[model samples]
Target: MASYWRTPKPGRKIPFIKKSPVENPIMEPSIPTHFRCPISLDLMKDPVTVSTGITYDRHSIETWFEVGNQTCPVTNNVLKSEELIPNHSLRRMIQDWCVANRSLGIERIPTPRIPVTPIQVSELLSEIASASRRGDRARCRELVAKIKALGRESERNWRCIVSGGAGRVLSASFSELAAGSFDNSTSGVLEEILSALAACFPLDEEAHWHIGSPESLNSLVLILNCGDLAGRLNAVLMLKELVSSLDADRINVVADTDGLIEALVKLIEKPISPQTTKASLVTTFYLASSSEMTAVKFVEMGLVSLLLEILVDSDKSMCEKALAVLDGVLESKKGRETASDHSLAVPVLVKKMFRVSDMATGFAVSALWKLCKNYEQERGEGCLVEALQVGAFQKLLLLLQVGCTGTTKEKASELLKLLNGMRGRGECIETVDFKALKRPF
Candidate 1:
């Protein structure tokens, strides 16, 4: 250590010590440089050495890799591997330092469990795969249980299992099990696989395809129908991710699955939780948007009525999602007929306008436009009249004045024209000066 002093000053030049540079003369404990994570600057609880020989907290380094950085944070060298080796010796020293500084309010870092390794994850996956081949359901379930536990340990372990191809392995097992018609004995194992599989999301492209395959779709259907709440929740969320990536042919295959639409509607009709309801709504929206046949099926299932019911009572997030699903449903003529027929649909949707968020208002206005456009050809037909009677006309006027996207503004303007049509011949739109008010848009 070098001896140094504060620059000679008017009064005193205090000598510097090896410690306490970062602390004040008022006597706070100084933290050592190596004890902190470079990224977070907090004490490193579970330090590991990266491929570049730089040590970091395990979580800190995993986050670094997760964000698409392959280079060392310190030296800027490209990392050859993502392996994280536990620095047990340094961790012990950190614990000891904390214990010695306990009087200064430092807490000891707990000893960390060994993180799952790629080879270990691969071996378990292999064992599970082999057991499935041998038709040893017990062994396969036990192995999946192990993977599920490891996945629960840390995001680092989940990354290990994901990169090692657990998604394909688990989906294949679930597909085969599901093919047996979903007996009582298989429920536990199926749930285990889904729990583990969902944790690996943001999966590799190959894994995504595996999960979205026709066989896996059957498994998802069975889970949605008879499996428990957690299982159904996982199924719908998985379907939401899967549907977006599927081509038109594959989505048509999805829409064609017998009893699939029924199960989804049941989930929405009898929502297990807000999360489950939201996931099913989003999944249904994607399917309905992708296929006209699917949209017709949902309309037949009274999805519009259910969504309007939700809009009348649900929370903000629920209302927004329900409105979005409603808008998608109205894309079909049958959906518009059902919505316009329902006693509360027009009023519920009109109630949402200018009240929730801009998105909700947009969806509400879009939906009204669809119904209005449907009945616009029939002058005395009541869709536009019904909307205006619920104060939708005033809300649309306010929405346009508040400012919106070009598309929404256009929709609002068109909706205004439609609602104004129900006015009497003497009570025309010209009575209210259209361009007199300043429109921010």
Candidate 2:
């Protein structure tokens, strides 16, 4: 019979070594409940061998390492642990366990098996990472199965590898999965991939506030290229939070901005659909506000021309949002400079002032007001009178007669005041009765 204490290896402390055998062996004593996993507090799975020759619950071992507590729980000897690839299901299981325990008012759960050896976990993660590097989806899936078999023990290390450094192997794998080449049969796998990436890629407020690594830009570009808008929106929100500067040389800030502009323009080019239009407009707003290079690129991409089209489009909301953005530009020094050229954009505004829709006319008059004021200090009053000559006063009268009844009146008064300055200076044309313009019809 194998003696219960048959004297094991020098460093190895196999708990089952001295236990019962097949025939007539003494019944193995029941381990106290306290010997169970501290995390799950259940029977430990695949207990890992630690450096000090002791064993512990795999999940508990991971938790200790996460918060810098890598010493063997029983032996109190330093134990090296491995870097983890994020496993979403295991993490959620652990999270669920924690939640359940907390509600039951448990304070601390005691671990039984020493966490799996760090070397073991690292070996598993390396295999998955290697598969990702080789673009071997099959091998990666196999490795995931092995890690998950460890149950909650794999959670922490899995998170680490998935979202760890600027260049994480697990993140790369998830990116590949998001590319849609993966079989739809494995969307459950895809969900895991996304969760792992999210966990690994949490925003680092300090790191972000200073400057971002090129890797951050790379991740964002991947997210943007994907067809999933929810994922894209999440990535955008992350960028907003980080406020990271893009590597202009490698990333081509201008081209990316142009692409975003092109997408927005395509969304609004035809008769705009309510859902897609709203989404596109929101996307445009995000792009406009994202970086300085964004607005500059929009101008370079001739977006001003398209914006002019939307300004005249039948949709009031679209025109209103587009003009509101233009208004922002006008308020800026750069926008002021851009509008001062006035060769093309100004004529569009001139044409829009006569538009039949009250909303369109309002936007047109408001934009003109900003443009007129922008050059008011530079071009002087003659430029303003010339603008009025191009049918500014006539449109103002039309707005006053029909469009100016409600909200138009306030803007009419403002335009009258703006035009009133040009009255005595520019070859003044007192077309509409000033008293008629002033009266609330």
Candidate 3:
């Protein structure tokens, strides 16, 4: 769970300052002149211990064998214990050398590359919108051809449409591009088509928002119904983003809600291929996670079992995404009560806590804790005590101790405090105390 995406740390490299005279005793010159290694009268480098775990470098002990200064000068006896002599001197010299030699001047980590320029993208998007308005399929295809020539993989995710989900794709040679052609009539139609494809296939915002009419949604649905699995998955992804700006109430009112939901549910139930199945599930998750509360509606319409099936799947990615969505749903106003009514939901999620591969168990635990909190608030303190009796508090405590890190520390601490208070040992709101939690587990 460590993020590799670190922001650049900006600062000048400040060199280590030498300690003041007060920091150390006055140096003795005769000791080093009398006892210096014959090879070189300088401090040791790469000091290490021998078989007896007694430390000595080539200049210290080996020099004793060579130049016959075996008996210690300062101790005035045989060098019995290297430990008796200070080790910090050697360590300090090595560190000082490294700082002087190996340091870089004002380290500059390379900035991450942005995929496309905003002005270029915005212009391309507006062209697509114009082509769609002008009904120039051939011109749109020509525009896409030039854009595609720009690069494929780099622009794969970057190509954005304004409202491709709402039907903008059709106006910009969407159907033609989906067929692997970009034959449109207008001079800049290729750019328009590319923008439309960006919006619809990649569902770029510029492309999606520029969607010409409702026909685009229908066109995408048709493409999903007819094309191969990738096409279908892409179509659903487009629909997910398009629906974000779209009023669900309007879509439900204007289009066939039962039809669209049924198609999505059917795809969720039986996808054409496993890859398609997973891709569709992700689209479903995006839809569920989308702000429209479509997932909640799907649950209210009795799609919980369908979603749970995905959540329990062996696929790790799907499980994580699905669990995140389920977590979100269970935290939502309506989803909270609905999840509580379902007896098996909590138990299944609790079991996931045991799996090492499920890195999302922390999120699951938090969601469940919140659900229980909501349940407690609605029911009574007695309900919380009942949940604690059922081992909720112990599980949460274990989760906090093991799983909590970075930002989650405060949350886990707060939850533990509350749960401890509810165990009836002390107070939480009025005062914070957890002396009872210190006992050996």
Say which candidate scores most in lDDT: 1
Question: What lDDT does the true structure give each of the candidates?
Answer: 0.79, 0.51, 0.50
Better of 2 and 3 by lDDT: 2
Best by TM-score: 1
What 10-residue stretch in candidate 1 is worst by lDDT? 12-21
Q: Give TM per candidate.
A: 0.83, 0.38, 0.47
Tens-digit lDDT track for model 2 on 272-308? 3455555455445445554556666555555565676
Q: Give the Å error, residue 241, model 3.
A: 5.6
lDDT (Cα, tens digit) per residue for candidate 3, span 12-103: 22222123222222432222221223234433443543334344444345334333333443344554433323345555555454455444
Candidate 1, 28-104: lDDT as tens digits:
47778898777666689999998778899887776666556667787889777777789989999999999998988
Candidates 1 and 2 compared: the better one by lDDT is 1
Candidate 3, residue 118: the lDDT equals 41
lDDT of 3: 0.50
